[model samples]
Target chain A: MKRRSNSDGKSVKAGRRGTAARKRRPLPTAARKRRHLRTAVRRRTASVGRRERRDQRLARELDDITEQQRATSAVLRLIGGSSGDLQPVFASILASAVRLCDAHTGVINRWDGEALQLIATHNMPPAYVELRKRSPYRPDQHSASGRMLATRAPIHIADLAADKTYLGGNPPTVAAVELAGVRTALAVPMWTEGKLVGSFTVGRLEVRPFTDKQMEIVQDFAAQAVIAVENTRLLTELRQRTDELRRSVGALQRERSNRLMNLEAMAAAISHEVRQPLASIAANCSAALRFLAHDPPNIEEVRAGLNRTVNDSHRASQVFDNIRALFGKADQGRQAVDLNGLARGVLDGLRGEIEDRGIIVELASAPDLPPIIGHRGQLQEVLINLVRNAIEAMDLMTDGRRTLKVRTERSAADKVSVTIEDSGPGIDPSQIKGIFEPFVTTKARGMGLGLALCRMIVERHAGQLSASPAQPRGSIFRVVLPAGRNAATDATG
Target chain B: MNGQPEPQPIVFVIDDDSALREALSSLFRSVGLQAKAFASTSEFLQMNLPEAPTCLVLDVRLPGLSGLDFQSELAKANIDIPIVFMTGHGDIPMTVRAMKAGAVEFLPKPFRDQDMLDAVQAGLDRDRSRRKNASDAAKLKATYDTLTAREQEVMRLVTAGLMNKQIAGKLGVSEITVKVHRGNAMRKMGAKSLAELVRMADALGVRRTMS
Candidate 1:
């Protein structure tokens, strides 16, 4: 029993020691729970702050993207308004790309079917501009812009220096980017009418690669740039078509007016040349009957009547030949002719009739009158008609105080003028302006074609003919002609 | 018809047209009259009139002076020739002006040959009486020249109804001498009696002045 009691005492002693060990080693659940709660709160707060920052950044980025889209759209609208010159549109696209992408430089490179030409650049150095001008890069296997054009896809370079796939090896564009402290770059094809016409490239100075969001923004702007180019092309095409139509319409109007003037001139020539000879014939016939009634018939008087009839018949034949010449289907023949000489010849031929009618004809010429280049026969016809009309107007003066003054002078640097003034009953003021029109005459027996035919002949020679009432009485007709080269040289001396 | 030779009629033709003038000369010759044509009044003025029977066929409008002016000139000269005026296209005023000037006939141009000839004949007949009277007056004057002044006084007294014895008492002569002067004067003057002598004197217009 004493042994069982000693064992019990030892058990108590061991139990006591075990209780002392339990006290010495307390339970760690509270500290562990506290440590676990503190860790969980710290992790949750950090997660929430990160989420807020991300949302704010996304909102700001979205606003930036919206602003960029609006700016690009506005630039495209401005390009559309400017009717098709590609310079302004290219400038706006390049400048907007630089601003929107926050890049150091931006360039719009045009692939003109054979070569890649830098059309527009924003934020590029002057030295780069000079370098690019000297060594123009062509679109080939060695060009960065060329690959983007050939593939018609987007290209990105995080570090141009480190990148292995740079097609254009250190060209001016790449060099310019390097000088601008740009490492990351993006290139997108610019399309027009579903064809890759050019490329839009954005470069950054730092090694911050373009995110998907930034790439999307750039692509949207690239799309807007392409639309602007296409709009400009259609505008250019419309402008060309309008110009062609205007030219055609103008030519048609000229043809119609020419035809009308020709028809009028033809009719006038026919009537004036035909009726005068017929008048002379009828008068001679009447005078012949009077001579036959003499008691001892005057043979001389009878002979005079017969001679007059024969002369008139010959004159009628000449008029017919002139008509044939006018109507013949022959091309106009151009020649150099002395206008002063022609005027003198016509005046000399008409001098006899003028003297018989008691009219005074005076000719005044410039010291060195110019020769005109034209059809000689046509010019003669014009001068003769004008001179004859002047003579006829003075026919009724009984006291024989009629004067026809023909004067010539140089009018302009390359033009010469001839003026014929007559002292007779002047053209009526109301009829002066329209005298060149057909069928307008003030003569009692006149066919009213003299002036109309004169206008046509003058116009055919590339000259102008016009008439005005003379100072006191009668009319003055002025003709202006382009002087020939020889004539001008002679005139200078 | 009265034992006298038929009077030769003279025709004066005037026309402006030379052809019509020759044609008219031929036409007048075919009718057996002495026809003379003058171009104008000036030509006709220098011409002498025939003593037989003369008729003027003058154009209305002559070169120097008009036909109406010529007619007036003829009247002023106391010419007793009858006029037959011709016209080309006569207006009423011209015709009336010609007829009032004692034209025997006014013939328009292009007239029938018969019409012209008849008009000429009528003018010549009227001119014949005037010429005969003028010639008779000249013959009376020649016969009277041979007589004394006493015989003319006796003729004037007898035609004035004074008897022969009264004429002898007024002139202090014997009745037989007065009767002898009257008988010689009447016979020399180609009068058959005293009344016949008075008739001749009246026809000569001597009796009007004597009375």
Candidate 2:
């Protein structure tokens, strides 16, 4: 500073001298021009020196920024390559942070809502690492990490030995000063979603506190650590959800296959039913042909065979018509039906027979039973058939007490049911499965189409018909119909 | 082809369907064979079966018992009869099982007339041969029953390929006595030669009693 001022003083003196010379002697224009040239050269040299100094400072700042960027990119690469494994990522982050901040060693401690768990360490003393290994201990308030937590911000201590905690014999501070030989310490907290998760701490062996730029770099590393932790947690959650979805899809596929199998069985049954009459037709045709080929050509026998063939053909076609009716669209004449009323009407029609058979008819109807949407006539046919079957079943008892139970109730929140129970000889357990099949009848005079047609009509109305052995000695038949659309209620209820 | 008269070969049709049963009966009648139709196995079982060649054309899916079960029931009752199985939908396992149980033919429904006739003919032919063998054995048994105890023993040993001397040692009698007994046994069994007597003993299963 004194040399620059002296130079200024010299220039001022020279200026005054030139003025005095100019006043003293008006003859020296060349000497004055030479003095002007000398002063211009000196000013040019001083400006060049200032420019060089500025350039050098700018280059140093650029180098620092480039190094910090390279370190950050390297840590990011580590996090990406680790693929949810945070151990190597934490280690890489601590190493890069310590190096970029110009510190000697570093430690990354995960705060698990309770205590400091030292997760990763880079170049730390063996004694300090051993001390950290045996613990879920909270750092004393004097330590760098403890202060970082308490303040919820970064802490920079230029000289740990001179801190009041060091004078007060804080164990971690004393340990940092004595065991780790750490003088200057910098600790930055890692935050994720507004919660402090961990701390990134670095210390130098010399009494040089980190620069603001270095503190910023350390904070960046802490943020990167938070991202890696968050990424791992999200990835794990994604995998678990994916597994659950796979299980649900598998269950749905199994259910679909079971339904397909049931459809196949139903088709097989239909084919069997159709084939019976077709076979009879073929046999009758063969018989007629054989009769025509007889030596005497039996004309009467041929006529009989031809007539049977016609009958069988008509029977086969009837089977097809029945199948069509079973699966056909009968939704045109649908209306709201009261099952209890339907049952009562059917019983009224059979009141004389019931009394003759000495059958005690019990009607138990729930007043709140919901109405169902169906073809009223078809549903009444079903009820009548079921009641007649129950009466016939009871009539065969001959000596036992005959009782008929007709019940109606809300089977479910969106369903209504009608049950017919008969006290008679129960169905043989083995023959129960085919009772609803066409041409399979337990009644001696039944054409066997009654129950099958009844079942089809019930199914077309979005209802289910099932049979089970009733209590003691009888059979129970139930028809469950879906309530109309407006009858929906909470399923949980 | 025997010189004696041939009784009519009857084909019994047992099926739950009345139309098919009647059609089958008509078909059999067209060929000049007696045909009887029954709606169930129990109905068929109640009839008096004549002493003639008879074949049963049974539906595989019967109301009371399956045709296969009927086959086993007939076997258990010692009523050996040829069964021609007819089914609306016969799977491979059912066909194989029926065939293994001595079914004459397992004809699926809607079979041609020629096939049904051929199956019934095969069944009748089998039953005819079986009946011929059974009657022949019964006749041989009647003839053999006329022999004395010593002659019967000699006949058994003779059918076992024993020489007269070996027969004498087995019976503890002289060789001359053995020859006498063999000659009388053959005479009673109506055997014209030793080979004929052995055949008669074989028919009566007398060789099996050669203890």
Candidate 1 chain B — worst ten consecutive residues by lDDT sum?
A: B202-211
- Give the alpha carbon lDDT tens digit for every residue of A97-142 in model 2: 8877778988888889878788888887888777777646576666
Docking class of 1: incorrect
DockQ of 2: 0.32
The single-chain TM-score for chain B of candidate 2 is 0.86
lDDT of 1 at A487: 38
lDDT against the true structure, per candidate, is 0.70, 0.77
Question: How good is the docking of model 1, as DockQ?
Answer: 0.01
Q: What's the C-alpha lDDT at position A78 in model 1?
A: 82
